[model samples]
Target chain A: MRYVTPRKAAVGLGASHTGTEHHWWMTVSSAALALLTPSFLMVMGTALQLPERADILLYFTRPYPAIVVAIFMTLGMMHFIKGSRIMIDDYLEHTARKVAIIGFSIFGWAVIAFTLFALARIQLAFAQAI
Target chain B: MADVNRGNRPLSPHLQVYQLPLAAITSIVNRAAGQAMVAGLLLLAFWLLGAAAGGGLWDWADWLTRSWFGFLVLLGSCWALWYHFLAGIRHFFYDAGEGLEIETARMTSIAIIAGSVILTLLSLIIYWI
Candidate 1:
């Protein structure tokens, strides 16, 4: 069985190598994020504030819901970075302006990377934390 | 215009070359965000699959994600989100008949970029702690 290389299978990135290398990851992330926003907004809007942080965590941790939340956080972070890249390019008119914009973008990626580490830990260690 | 100064400027097929309207720029940004969100979901799927498969498949993913490079890519996505989230809101605003003027639209665009950066940093502080 042969698996396709990135160059071969990234049809979404064809002709021009943009927004295609991470197609599956991006699509799934968007879908999950798309599902999560409304739910989180609802949960945040009505709650009378939990007494303990851990309790709040516990409330969100039950199986399917927890999974959804995790997906939400991950996709939210991912989309932000890719989205920013486009935005930066839009307003940065000068060459230096573009560089500065891109530099800020790199920082965005940095934040996501660190946040993911936290997410991975929280998701995998769900049983032990409680 | 940036092009007014140069005699023969080499144009690199770019989005900036287009006479972009607020609607057009907003659409482009939304698509970028939509695509990236999709990537994030895919990454989550890998994690979920790993969690499901038991064995050590998921653990391997966990390990990679925790690695230096994986962390970097993930962080990039985080930024993508903060920016897109705001940009998405801007679109919603536009949909509601706001930021229609050229100046107002551009200002809103700038605001979206600045606000997203600020928010992304805030999340990192919380996450890092």
Candidate 2:
């Protein structure tokens, strides 16, 4: 049989072998989001009270609001994908697990793509208006 | 073989048997909230797409969201979002090898539930003012 060195074993791959990596990525994104989420709420919350149409467009056209929302959407979706994976693994088995993971992953990436596209379109509109 | 004695062995604690601790319950609820927010994200996408489409689409989204039922859903989602966010932060601390003690876990569990509610109310207050 093949052998892993003490150093390799110490890395703690665990049964799934990807546990640590997934944990670290989720942790880092979670930390980033912990900071970003409050700001995200503030941005969206402010935009909510603005007068319809013109004021709302003017608000989102600014770099800060657009950029903040974009980053938060991206990071938050990434975290959601991983978090959903863990939950799927816990409660699902066999074919269901595979199907749920695929479904959730596609859903997450689709949101990311759609949000980015919308933000870019907004930015383009803002630029053309100037 | 290892399986020889396992045939008659009792199963481990599971949903029907074990009384879950506060921290375990918090973690489970956090997962549920995360899953629920997936639906919320779809609504958010609908709003963004409406914004991009313009020509009254944005107005429609805003009108629907401001309706009483829609507003209630939004409030519930807001609570879930904040709760999941804080729970994520707490998990980060645990991942880093900190706050593993029982007392710490219990306190953090309570903190997450309380903090999320407070943050949700605070945001609503800010939105209204």
Candidate 3:
């Protein structure tokens, strides 16, 4: 269907609310930005800018840089999710859309959770060495 | 859609309020985002490149952090990063069925600005290295 029927729209009270500009912004940003994220990650995977690199693990075992990494990962992961959430909302209109959305939703949460896990468990060897 | 009627007179399409004009707002968002993306990618790519260059170059980066110029640049980046982060949070709240009122929107606008600065300073102080 091109658009929601009036009756369906009435039943979709929260759905209409879900379909907002902010949601669109996040969705559009997520899908569009996803194109950039993987490239950046591949770069990070090879590079050693993380705190624990360069035989300097001892220097970086402090609290400040750890906080920085924690902030960066947490914010980046959350942004990635809301962004992809927007993409799912806008383009997934089929019957399997629910499953797709759920799957992606879990993936996003998993990324955030994993990032948090690393943030808490960061050690010089693993965190810095990549 | 039926045209809005007012006092028995047919009203023209209410081109939504463009306080500064639609083109201007779009231009603002586009330009700000463009500047941010350019700077952000450059920083990310440069850091990766530096890391790939090995220890000597990496040591130099650590030294740069001590310089006035580098510190200023990092400070600016902190602002940008936190600004984007807070804005993303605002967007998240909108997704969660909050922050839709006129008052709340204004609060979020100010809050994002304040939050960015506050978070940046807090992160800096709380940093590991």
Candidate 4:
């Protein structure tokens, strides 16, 4: 009753060689993002409305807002990395596709790193001042 | 057993020849919106980094984001976010084996498009108020 052929079973993954991992992760991240998007939007909306630089910084200094942003940015970028790779795979081929995937993966990670670093700095500065 | 005629064979109707259905259009737009959100995220990262760095960097980023050009970009980003978000929900329903009927799918596709616009406008109005 096994649907898979002997070769497919031996190879484990399907023709693409990626199996279902990409789709699985994309589903998980998309579900998490479904919740995170609204909360993050509210946080960003409130932060942007503040007129003063210090006030904006102070707003993110609070643990709740900071945590929301940190999680959102990290998860969102990870989702983007996976999602964009699929899009690139569909439209590009060979060398160009390889380069685009690598470029986007690096960009996504850098954004995550920069976002966490900024959030940390905001928290540290607020701590030192008070 | 190479019988030839591979290159000469007529192919199925492709993107150019076929008019895509509503569901197909919505699905493709969802992908496009996801990419747009990436650009929006980069703008957000710049804003955050500038705030953390402070001084001239913050001033420059703040001014840039507050400018008319930036406003347009943010507005588009807002719409993209809503469109993608609603499309994600539709996808979830599809995954769960719901709303897969042709009529239902078309209705939901239209709802996504209209709902996203309404939500985007509502968010902006709330922000302005």
TM-score of each candidate structure, all chains considered together? 0.48, 0.85, 0.42, 0.89
Across B1-129, the per-residue lDDT of candidate 3 in tens digits comes to: 787555777556565742554333332443244235333333433343344344685567555544576556655655665565456555567767897776677666766667767876775564433
lDDT of 3 at B27: 29
Over the stretch A42-97, how does candidate 2's per-residue lDDT look in tens digits? 88778767766667777888889888889988988899999888889989999999
Reference-based lDDT, residue B32, model 3? 47
Which structure is stronger by lDDT: 1 or 4? 4
Q: Which candidate, 2 or 3, would have the higher lDDT against the true structure? A: 2
Please report, as a residue range, the 10-residue window in candidate 2 chain A with the lowest summed lDDT.
A48-57
lDDT for each residue of candidate 1 in A36-62, tens digit (9 for 90 to 100) = 765643342222134333453455446
Report the Cα lDDT for residue A62, model 3.
Answer: 49
Query: Could you tell which candidate, 1 or 4, scores higher by TM-score?
Result: 4
| Number of the candidate with higher DockQ, 2 or 3 | 2
- Candidate 1 docking: what grade? incorrect
Give the alpha carbon lDDT tens digit for every residue of B1-129 in model 1. 565766677776667676777556665865665556445444544544444344586567556655676556555666666666677666556656987898898788778777867876775565554
Interface DockQ per candidate: 0.04, 0.53, 0.03, 0.67
Q: Write candidate 3's Cα lDDT for A96-123 as tens digits.
A: 6777767756755665555445334435
Error of 2 at B83 (Å): 1.3
Candidate 3, residue A101: how far the Cα is off, in Å: 26
RMSD of 2: 5.6
